[model samples]
Target: MTVRELLTEMKDTSEVIIDLAYASLMYNSSTMAEKVRGLEDDMDDLKFATRYKVLLSSRTREDARQLSGILEVASAADRISDAASDIVSLLRFPPEKRPFITEMLSEADEKIRMIKISSDSSMVGNTIGRLQIEASTGCKIIAIKNRRGWTYDPEDEMKLRANDVIIVRGTDDGADLLVEYAAGRKEWEFEEIVPDDVIEDEAEEDLQNEEELSEEIRGEGDEE
Candidate 1:
């Protein structure tokens, strides 16, 4: 497979490993722990494959420079898998001393969700960075699962394909927007969601302006 495909698989795999690890801690299940450990082996294999591909693909200095980005992104995926292993290590701690990491994640304003890319998705050929999903919808892609495998936090050059499953973190609204957009059901548009405070401020300003306009009309009528 191509380098992008390998990276894509690596990224998706890493996300699964981390999430499985997280779930293990959540339920305190040895079964999930075993799954995480098994996935780590897959992650290791992908990492090596990615590294070999990068080296094989590069020729010139410029080529190496471009390839470096792939290595960095792959390394990042490996680090996440390693981190999952570290998190699983927490099981060794006494139940009383275990960290509530998943609890804290649940409290965040945004949540992670998986979205499937439609066959006709406009995002199919676009790289994650090029699609500008995060900037457009305020949703950040954390992982993607394609035919080759799962990849964690794909790089800028990781071109998307049809039927890819992407994991993203964002508010509910943002996640919905991304899901629709990726499915080609909606086009990209910036819809700013004003905060309650901003909405209140705008309403107050409008009321003041309306009052001033009314007074101005009354004054004009008197002058007339």
Candidate 2:
């Protein structure tokens, strides 16, 4: 199947899985497992399509591996969604118990802040550890989208290469700091005037690093 076809199938199957999870949460236990089984079947079909696309395409092995990894993540997400719904179902206790449950859910949801980072930015070149340090100084890089559209976890150790968009979770001030950092401004210098010499030196260092990294990669390729 074509990439579009595979993607469409994946989307459809994913929706089915979501629907099953919702149904399980809203309905009785007698029928919940059956619906979950059907969802599992749909997930299997998605995996099959993903495998077929990877195996039949002329893409490089690395590309295929990446695609496989994405499918695996999707599968895992589906499972987690199902589990979350199951937990939600358990919260269907009497009215007295629901207030506490509602408060817990609200607290859980409120703790997370979602902010997207533009793909084209200096923050893309930084490592996760670097991003985390920046976050601790008040900007959290919670997730990232690599070129393949797969989201990277905060601690994945995958360097934030250019063209990767990131999602940060933090307070409003923290998110603002992240945006400023992504735009190449330090938190402490957000409002301060940048000296020309500092800018020039940073630019020179960046260019030198780019050339060195390129040469290193090229040398590795040659050795291989």
Candidate 3:
């Protein structure tokens, strides 16, 4: 990959790894902690690749001066990944000792939660767009893990299945409501939703039709 691509990957990896690390703490899941560690390794590899590319491309004083900034940014992203790794280290301690941490997270304005979809859930066999998940429950899904693997910032068309695990971020109330749907404790109920892109397209079409009608009326008046 090019240096620019490597840096971009590093930045994205750093952000997502940090979120997942905190989520591991919130859910007390060793599985999530392991995922963080795997990403930390990827971050290390990205840092090395970025440094190598930057150094190989620098052939003069001017080149070095211009490329130094890239190295600095890469180092900063590396530090962020390191910090995320440290956060997951809290998992090594006993769960009883971490109640205070969970308490603090609960009091925050927004929280991260992991929900497992049950077989009997009404959410089964539905796409995220069809269910209008965020619109209906106010929670945004950040990632999903299933038999296929982990998907970050999952698309609206991604379908839900039984035993799928989703990570969501939102207010506590929203998370609670979504949890009920995932656990099959409450049925999902909401009015049908039209996607924002579809609404925008329809509005643009209407505007174009009005303009065409105005042009036709002006042409008739000129002929008369």
Candidate 4:
């Protein structure tokens, strides 16, 4: 099959997985078990298609390797989903039996805290460095969402403008502390700043090198 056809099939399979997840959330254990089985089947089909594409493509070995790695990740996700479904099924006994299960799920969800912040303050600088220094409580900046772009790396150095959303990952207490600080109720100290352009240039250079390597492999294949 062509690349476009493979990608379309993958999208459809992803939709089925999402639907199964939603059904599990709303239905009982018996019903969700069946849906989870169906999702596992769809995931297997996607894994087969991904592997087929990588095996058939001949332009770049690096591209094939990357696609193979993606298939591996998909397989792992499918396994984790199936295991979770099994655990959920065991909690269908009685009201008293479900307390432990409920507690476990709640604890798992509470560990990963997500906090949203706005960069429209006057004391904050325009880049991530200032935010990192200002929010100095061992909290890490995981993602940045803006009107112009969305980044998921620590290397993001774009100027934070008004209405920009910054997603920070930390503990529950740390996230709460950040929210309090952002609301002007708490005091914070500042530190040195770094230019955004320097980080952007490094990222650009890395991308350029990867592209050049791919092009070189394509040219060698053409010469043969």
Candidate 5:
């Protein structure tokens, strides 16, 4: 991968690792901890690859000066991954010894939660951009999992489907609202409201269609 692509991957990977690492500790899941460890390995590999690319690209004094910043960013991302790995290391202790983890997470300003979309949800057919999920719910989607695989930092144009599992970060109230929408228990309301005239027009159209259907049925009865 090019340096830009590698850096993007590293950023996404590091962010995911941090969230997953804390989630692992909060939920007491060894599986999540193991995933963090694997990602840490990947981060290391990315760091090395990035350095190799940067070194090859730096051909002069000016090139070296410009390229140094990229290395700094890569090192920062690597340190973030390392910190995440450290967070998950608490999993090595016995459950009883680390009971405070969940409590600490609960008290945090932002909480990460995984929500599954229901088949009947209004969100099933909408793209993230159309939904304006963050604007309405105040929760930002971090990752999504469908049958195909996981998408981290999903794009605005990404469409939601039934049974897609989304990981989001937000306040408790925001999470609850998003959960309700995802479960089909609540309808989505956007900042842009349809004009009353437009709604009335639609209602009039439906009435006209119903009347036309009735007239057709009556004419058929007369023929009989």
Candidate 6:
């Protein structure tokens, strides 16, 4: 890949890592946290690949200077992903006991969600941009997984296919709405005045209680 393409890919993966990591924290999912770590490893490989390619291509002092700037930008993206991973690392602690951290999470306005396109779904054969997910449901598609593997920051014309897993970040209500639409359940779509389930843990009932307590301590009501 060219340096510009690599840089764009770096930015795309960077967003996915951080967003998914923070989502892991909010849901207390070790599985998701580990996934972010795996993605971080992928990012490291991309970094090395970009550097190696650039080293071979740098032929002049001016080229070296610009390449250095590109490397710096890529490093900054890596750092942001690292910071998000650090946040996920703290999820090993119980949320109830970490009242401060839980409080912070409770206040998060954005959330991560994933939806799989069904074979019969209207979204199956359209481009992401054509779907207008952000414009329609206020959700941003960050990554797409298919036979081609994960495509981060796909262009407007990038085709959506059956069984493509789309990762998105947006408000809880918006994400829910989008999930239904993406899954060919448009009839089930509705405005979520209060999200039905905010926590993704298997022991959701207990976690909900803990979250309620955390909110009470923070002088907030239970999540609907």
Query: TM-scores for all candidates?
Result: 0.48, 0.33, 0.69, 0.36, 0.71, 0.60
Instruction: Residues 81-152, candidate 6: write the lDDT tens digits.
Output: 888778888887887766766566556798666688888677777776667667788888766788987665
Candidate 3, residues 6-29, lDDT tens digits: the string is: 989889888878878888888888
Ranking the candidates on TM-score from highest down gives 5, 3, 6, 1, 4, 2
Name the regions of candidate 4 deviating beyond 4 angstroms.
Answer: 1-29, 58-60, 91-95, 106-224
Best by TM-score: 5
lDDT of 5 by residue, 1-224 (tens): 99999999999888878888887777677766787898999999999999999999999999999889999999999999999999998988987898787778788998988899999899998999999999999998877888887766689999999999998888999999999999999987755777999999999999999999999999896787
Enumerate clash totals for all models, in the order shown: 9, 2, 0, 0, 0, 0
Judging by TM-score, tell me the better candidate of 3 and 5. 5
Task: List the global CA lDDT of all models.
Answer: 0.78, 0.54, 0.89, 0.55, 0.89, 0.77
Superposed by TM-score, candidate 2 places the C-alpha of residue 214 at a distance from the truth, in angstroms, of 51
lDDT (Cα) of model 4? 0.55
Q: Give the 10-residue window scoring lowest on summed lDDT in candidate 4.
A: 19-28
Question: Candidate 3: misplaced stretches above 4 Å?
Answer: 118-123, 126-158, 173-224
**Selected candidate, larger TM-score, 1 vs 4:** 1
Better of 1 and 5 by TM-score: 5
- Between prediction 2 and prediction 4, the one with superior TM-score is 4
Where model 1 places Cα greater than 4 Å from the true spot, the runs are 99-224
What is residue 43's positional error in candidate 2, in angstroms? 17
- Residues 42-86 of candidate 4: C-alpha lDDT, one tens digit per residue: 666766776676676746878767776766665665565556456
